[model samples]
Target: MKVYLDNVGERRLIGRADVPSEAGPVWIVRLFGSALIIKEHYTIGTVTHVPDGGARPLMERAVLLARGQPPELLPGWQALAP
Candidate 1:
């Protein structure tokens, strides 16, 4: 999944991802082979990854939270961005 900062600099879920029913620290499982466990005190408008697989196996992953507006493409393809 990809994350981006909205106009007000709030962390907004973008790309192919889902938000939990209750906010705060939580782990999210995607349809494919990627996941993220957000922390309670994590910055709202930023991208983060669980460094060493606290909830899943270790894998090389990178996420680019939007600095402004999200890209105008369909889901599942945003990860290809640098």
Candidate 2:
């Protein structure tokens, strides 16, 4: 799933990471610009953004919606993940 955060002029390309689990799959997100590694651990409900060069982390609470349910977005239209 790709998430476009137009409010901040950023885009993220996400894919499932290789892990064994029945709860929820871990996701690997690549943020545009800068070498920031973002990982979403669904079981913990947290999104961690760690920037390179020893910068501070930017974390946020994330909600995982079920398949076929799209995440809320702003006025601009967004493509629903399939």
* Index of the highest-lDDT prediction: 2
After TM-score superposition, the amount by which residue 39's alpha carbon in candidate 2 deviates from its true location, in angstroms, is 28
In model 1, the runs with Cα more than 4 Å from the true position are 16-45, 48-70, 73-82
Name model 2 segments beyond 4 Å from true.
1-44, 66-77, 80-82
Each prediction's whole-model lDDT (CA): 0.36, 0.37
lDDT of 2: 0.37
Candidate with maximal TM-score: 2
Per-residue lDDT tens digits of candidate 1, residues 1-82?
3444344544444443233324334332233343344222212223444565576443322233435433433234343333
After TM-score superposition, what is the CA distance of residue 42 in candidate 2 from its true location, in Å?
A: 12
Write candidate 2's Cα lDDT for 1-82 as tens digits.
2232222324343333222333234333333465465432222134568899889998744333334323332112244456
Task: Please report, as a residue range, the 10-residue window in candidate 1 with the lowest summed lDDT.
Answer: 38-47
What's model 2's TM-score?
A: 0.27
Clashing pairs for model 2 are none
How displaced is residue 38 in candidate 2, in Å? Answer: 34
